[model samples]
Target chain A: METPLSRTDRTRLGRHAERAGTTRSDLDAVLDQGMVCHLGVVVNGSPRVIPTGYGRIGGTLYLHGSTGASSLAASPSQEVCVTVTHLDGVVLARSVFNHSLNYRSAIIYGVPRPVTDPDEKLAGLRAITERLAPGQWDHARLPTRKELAATTVLALPLTEASVKVRQGPPIDEDEDYALDLWAGVLPVRQVLDAPEPDPRLPPGVPVPPHIARRATPTS
Target chain B: METPLSRTDRTRLGRHAERAGTTRSDLDAVLDQGMVCHLGVVVNGSPRVIPTGYGRIGGTLYLHGSTGASSLAASPSQEVCVTVTHLDGVVLARSVFNHSLNYRSAIIYGVPRPVTDPDEKLAGLRAITERLAPGQWDHARLPTRKELAATTVLALPLTEASVKVRQGPPIDEDEDYALDLWAGVLPVRQVLDAPEPDPRLPPGVPVPPHIARRATPTS
Candidate 1:
């Protein structure tokens, strides 16, 4: 059986407790499905939230950036928060106060450790690359020594994370439901369009199957 | 002429300086195009990033949440970072190290002030609602006195902000481009699906024009 997520005071949900997801699977689902995450770190005594790519393998989340990036440089010594959110839909209600968004969000809190071990760094980089493009790690040329040296990878354990999901229709006041107004959900989705080959790319190089599969309509 | 965005040491980009946007229009475009934002605030000496909905009006950005929310309650006294990111596509390169994402992101840092003036509070709430669902504030029942009191609205000025955009194909090494591998961009987009009327909603109340317009394909 999969383990339940550890609930510290920080991970506990105080409001809308019903929206909290307690399983490790919940956290993984939210993290895996997202292509990018907002990384929050305190710099110069103020919070700085940055949108960056991220990856997850088992219980650890991996983030990589240029070694000279200020946010990555300042993160190792302090507690940082990483959040992934998927906006599912916009809930329209009979009342303005009742309108809401259907979304799945995961927040992870921990002090990250810089990955220095060669084997682990390679694995972390692979995970990050694969997360961004599933088959590209094997298809593309692997990073050379100098490229790896220029990158900084940080591993954050998923021991302290929380997932919250809000879905379904808006919960309007009982009286408002009787009003002669329309109410519903406008679903939102992320879709991949046709691939545009690089202008510099040589002629007759077809798009790979892995990338083509994403453009196919699932529904 | 539009006022150029203020440049402070914190807002300055050390790496990829060419990607930084200096005009106020750039910041507004990024903010207005996104439906949700990641809010970062420090709580208990640790950074906390929450995925929340926000609205922008001129020089002020407004965010609303239940008064009981811990993140909202702790944010007014300290500096917070709000980031909005729209992923345009995934850049495929000949090498793993050169892969990147095409995106536009805006980051705003400021100390938020609670909106206490009754007119401003209502206006803030209206902006928040309108942002989530355009034409919603006018169609839905306005918040009553008790509902307004139950909500907390925080307004952050757009004085300290930055915008960054990365677009086009990956910048691969000169030699790697000659390899016979597919290199391109797989575009990513947020699209709206058909509206799902609330099951509890009474029949014969048609989907409003505002909501219907979103479901129509833009491209």
Candidate 2:
């Protein structure tokens, strides 16, 4: 059986509360679809939001940075908010008052634990790499012990997370629907273009099928 | 001549400092290209990052939310971090240790002021609308007084901001470049797909050319 998602007071949606969901699967879907997330932490008594890549393994979300960076080095004791957002479409309404974006966003809140165990650290790093490139973990060279020692990885449990989604066409007032104007959704998609090989690469290395397939739009 | 961007100690880049830029144009480019941003604010003594839409006019950035939402309500006093990010490509290196994303991001720090004047509110609303869909404000119905009263609009000066950018292929170590593997970048672009009109519309109302042109990729 799968565990259900719970919202502590921190994760509760304050406004537009109707869009919030508490299911673990909903949290998983949003996490699985995104490659980058904004890590929010308070620095010097002020909030600082940094954009970085993340990967989820089971119920734990892994984020890594230089051991010297303040965001990870100072994250062990305090609470952090990690957010992943996907822009699905632009909702153009008949009135400026009703304009909105169709999007799916997940925000997770928790105090992260430092990953010190070697076994779990490798696995976490693998998940982060594979999430960005599905087959590259096995295709590329794994991290060396020295390299791992220099990096700092933090794991934030997905215990308190909220998913808010706004989709479909804009809802205009009843009177404005009659106005003679264009109204619809301009769908936005993140597509991968053709791969560009490194200039120093050998003459015969062909683009791997795993990377080539991503050239087409997925989701 | 355009005013150059200045960086306060808080806005200075702390890590990967090479990617940071203090030019005001760099800040403008990132903001103009993105439609959605994550607004980080402290709510209930914990950091909360909310994904919302924003618009920029000159040195002021405008954000709006329902008057009942706590994020906008509490934003007047405390500092807020507004981030706009564009994921340019996925950098797949020869080693997992060096895997990174190519992206452009802008982080702005300031205390947002509540816009009280009705004229500035409408102008701000128009800028927000037109930024999302160019020529949209002129094409859509203007907001009514009652609708404007129900929304809360906040403006923050662009003076205290920083832009960080990372681009190009992955940078692998000297030894790892000798490995026999495919290594390159997968360019990611946000493209607009064909527009889907509202089904309830009259049969003959066609999509305006301004909206139709967006069907093709720009930038």
Candidate 3:
């Protein structure tokens, strides 16, 4: 379990901090809620962060990418820091600097070693697939041996991870209180529009329940 | 003026990219479209990447955080890289490694200097607030000099920025295409919910036009 590095690092507002809470279940809850993540790694002594798809299994984060990918594949041996964030709402404040965001984010720091075992590689791949669009794995084609060989999957134990959160109303200075400014949270969320059926579907292909529900976002 | 670094770095189709068709508007379209960006930098010879809200003015990226914030505030003075990504969708493929995303992303590399000038600092602060939520600056209270003093904002010139994108159907191995599997692009998008009125707005303060129009995301 990870705690705020120090007291100050923990946000002051009790509610906002609770909203930013991290639990064993929160990890799976948010991770199951989204598929893509931003991957940050050091290359040539500089930080390079790229967005990629990742799946979480228990306390391990499984990430897969092209073996030929420039940065991720090139620097396979280095310790990488991976983060996945879902922006829930925009917390508007009375003061510009006080503007805050209601978001759920997970940051993991660990050395990610490339997975070489063939069986583990396939499992890792499936986890990422199902994580993105549930039940799509059975609906879609599975990977071939050669394809799996050519691809790269990395497994990072979610040992050193941190979660920080800020949500709700803005905290402004006392003087700004009497100012005539509109202040509140302008809730921002992701909505799934009517799914556009695949162009070549074999007629009457009903939309799956998972995909349908995912289309409608609850902020 | 940002050039593709190499074949691998370019944002094109039939290649390893996502969200291919999203247009690359001159700096404004991309910058104005999104508020949060991942700032990647090296700390103590290690790569440290963190996500924070930002605003772009002309050709500069302005970022702010508490003066006492750990690591992030101190990073601007050193070499830093910033990536702004607007995710359009998740490209679930027949193969796991081929599983990708559709997004518009900008990567900027440079050395950022802290904003000591009071005027530039003020403007940077406004840009961040407005970028997060349009019309926020006008409605929200502006920052005070003393509060501003407690925050640090850095403006990094966007000279070496590069945009990479991918959108559309997934390309799988020829044989895998015949391997009865479901695979296609599942578009992911962000939406804005109805504005939540402030608790102290004295009830029935009709929402502003900007806020009303943005009830649903245009991005």
DockQ metric, candidate 3 = 0.49
Screening candidate 2 with a backbone cut-off below 3 angstroms (N, C-alpha, C), the clashing residue pairs are none
Candidate models: Cα lDDT each: 0.93, 0.87, 0.69
Q: Which pairs clash in the backbone of model 1?
A: none
| lDDT digits (tens) for residues A31-74 of candidate 1 | 88989999999998899999988888899999999999999999
Candidate 3 per-residue lDDT, tens place, A115-143, comes to 98888888787788887767766666667
TM-score of every candidate's chain A: 0.98, 0.95, 0.83
What's the count of clashing pairs in each model shown?
0, 0, 14
CAPRI-style docking class of model 1 based on DockQ: high
Q: For model 2, how does the per-residue alpha-carbon lDDT over B47-70 read when each residue is reduced to its tens digit?
A: 878888899999999998889887
* Candidate 2 total steric clashes: 0
Instruction: For residue B94, give model 3's deviation from the true position in Å.
Output: 4.5
Off by over 4 Å in 1: none
Query: Following a full C-alpha superposition, what root-mean-square deviation does model 3 have from the true structure?
Result: 4.2
> In lDDT terms, how accurate is model 2?
0.87
Candidate 2, chain B, TM-score (2 decimals):
0.96
The best candidate in terms of lDDT: 1
Which 10-residue window in model 3 chain A sums to the lowest lDDT? A5-14
